[model samples]
Target: MPLALYMLGLAVFAQGTSEFMLSGLVPDIAADLQVSLPVAGTLTSVFALGMVVGAPLTAVVGLRWCRRRALLSFLAAFVLAHVVGAITTSFGVLLATRAVGALANAGFLAVGLATAAGMVEANAKGRATSVLLGGVTLACVAGVPAGALLGQLLGWRSAFWAVALVSVPAFHAILRWVPATTSAATGRGAGPSGAGASGASGASGARAGDFRARRELRALRRPRLLVLLALGALVNGATFCTFTYLAPLVTGPAGLAEAWVPVVLALFGIGSFAGVTIAGRLSDARPMRLLVPGGLALLVGWLLFPAVVDHAIAVFALVLVQGALSFAVGSTLIARVLYEAVEAPSLGGAFATAAFNVGAAVGPSLGGAAIGAGLGHRAPLSVSALLVAAAFGTAGLALAVRRVRARRGEPAGRTLTS
Candidate 1:
């Protein structure tokens, strides 16, 4: 992998930390802002909504600039938003900052994935994307917990300040290490080298950005691809539905002390880190292997959460397992989307980001509604289980379709399973 790939991962870590830390700070934010808990939960939904809206919005605008330039521009805006968020006293202002920052975040990720995929050999795209996404999982491992601790000690606003400060170094890293040519913006592959295949590598490089934005949009309408997008939404929605309220869940039904919340979160982070890394290594050759088991694990974990909430040890262990299961197949899902839209890698990447945030928005909103309805803290997990089961059904339908095509001797676009 290129140094740019690692740097992209670092960039993801910085932005992702800012995104995930809000979960732990929801209670503090509610108290400090004099808002109700359900209202504070909307912060997560708002950020996700920004991501869904910002991805294509930025993709169209960013097409004029190279990937490196666009990434830097987005990061600058993201950092600025955090700075504003850190200082803002009004909840409305704070929410506006999250929306603006999410726009930047979505754009950066979409461009960054396209750039990373272009920077490597054809066979290495999966690993490159995994490394990039690993940064997000790593944020879970270190950044989120530390931010939660900072919020616990200093205040929720201090966490935003820390995010702002940490992002500065990432900005420098991208400017220094990521090259200017690392974009598919002008229908030219930009990177250190082309994808390894000789004949199929397009005029400039990979089969990236060859299609116009309109064609890319059209390609995304494929039935299987739509199912994949829905799958991404469901997977992420299930994860966040429970995750956004994790602090309270642990403190209440899980019977853990408030002091132990961060520790448990750290454990969840560790599981996520391992799951992403492992899933990444398998993504290129055995995506279904990861997806099937990972989805099943998610279903099982969510189902178990409601039953085991009163058992402290059981809940702690479940949190770790659930975290791992939630994120383990992420790279596989991303790889599937890229494969499904190989002709329009950047748009494909943008769609992947959008699908995720769509779920991000849906999950928290439903969870918050459940909480608002006077359902117990455990309601989120039940909601999560139903969502995961739906995702699993979608995946099953996809597999069944693949089998039907195989029987008819029709070509399956890209082979996900051997």
Candidate 2:
């Protein structure tokens, strides 16, 4: 609800656009760089790898700085990387720049979530996180499509330049509005105004340094917490496997025009926005219940994808459901991880984010391999269905673990159903 949250959303929008736009521009990038499409496609794979490597990597290093400072620093790095990507002519140089940008993107997100959670009252945590993540959904809806359009009109490099220009204002907004709260200081029983808690809120005035880092890492070692991370990874992997190649699928076998690809993707984005908004509120109230339905929706959507691809109307309708279901799981899973690692929510949340990135990295590689093996568009979708089923299984496993713990007279830690 704060003005700063809106600014943070803008920063996320720029980052998300830069991250997802590459998928749409893969052909252009390939042509411009004088490389094959599959080789050019590695741009995305490298970015995902950066995210997987960067999330926890930055989280560990960022423990020594104020959250606000770290966020600003990462955004600045993101801006620089985009600029480097826009100007570089060599394929290797562009790839390195993208990887660096990916690292910044990962750190920005991990810190951003932790920062947003710190910004609001405990009861409003889900809403705060949702608002932050909305930028990512918006990117899918608006940013990627627009970038693709720019690539079509100008060049792939031009699209990166445009993103770089957007990042300028985003960076300024972050520096001006984001508060300088450290992780430990932010967790002192609520905000400074007594808006959510009573008594001296600053009772536990710990410094943000090595001691805090060790404590946070220790909290993340819980089994229930680790399971949540794996679940997040699996679900994300399932989605991205098909999602990254959607444009190709729709245009190739689905018989859709290249121009319409962005529009359909935007529709999915609209669904994602709706899903995130609805799921954010529900997850905070009941995570386990939300996860069951969310996982089922994902499973059903993937299974039905093969049937719907040939018809425009069917593809549109299916994408809406797919987007909604896929994103709906985010807040619930995040809340579950944080709840389980109550003593050190930041590290647990960061680990879960890392897991998600790991999935992102794996999904595209698997999808690309399937496509490379002489299987067509259907291969990726079918594989996505299987992955979603595995995610469902993981969710079930999490639920069973909770029940077993409850019966054993031990704390179930946290319920995904909340």
Runs of candidate 1 exceeding 4 Å displacement: 24-42, 88-92, 152-155, 185-211, 371-375, 401-412
Which stretches of model 2 miss by more than 4 angstroms?
31-36, 184-208, 372-375, 402-411
- lDDT per prediction? 0.80, 0.76
Residue-wise C-alpha lDDT for candidate 2, range 292-342, written one tens digit per residue: 877887888898889878888888898888888788885567766755666
Q: What pairs collide in candidate 1?
A: none
Error of 1 at 206 (Å): 22
Report the C-alpha lDDT of model 1 over 47-103, residue by residue, as the tens digit. Answer: 877899898778755655556677889989998999999888889999999999999
How many pairs collide in each candidate, listed in order? 0, 8
Q: Return the lDDT, model 1, position 215.
A: 67
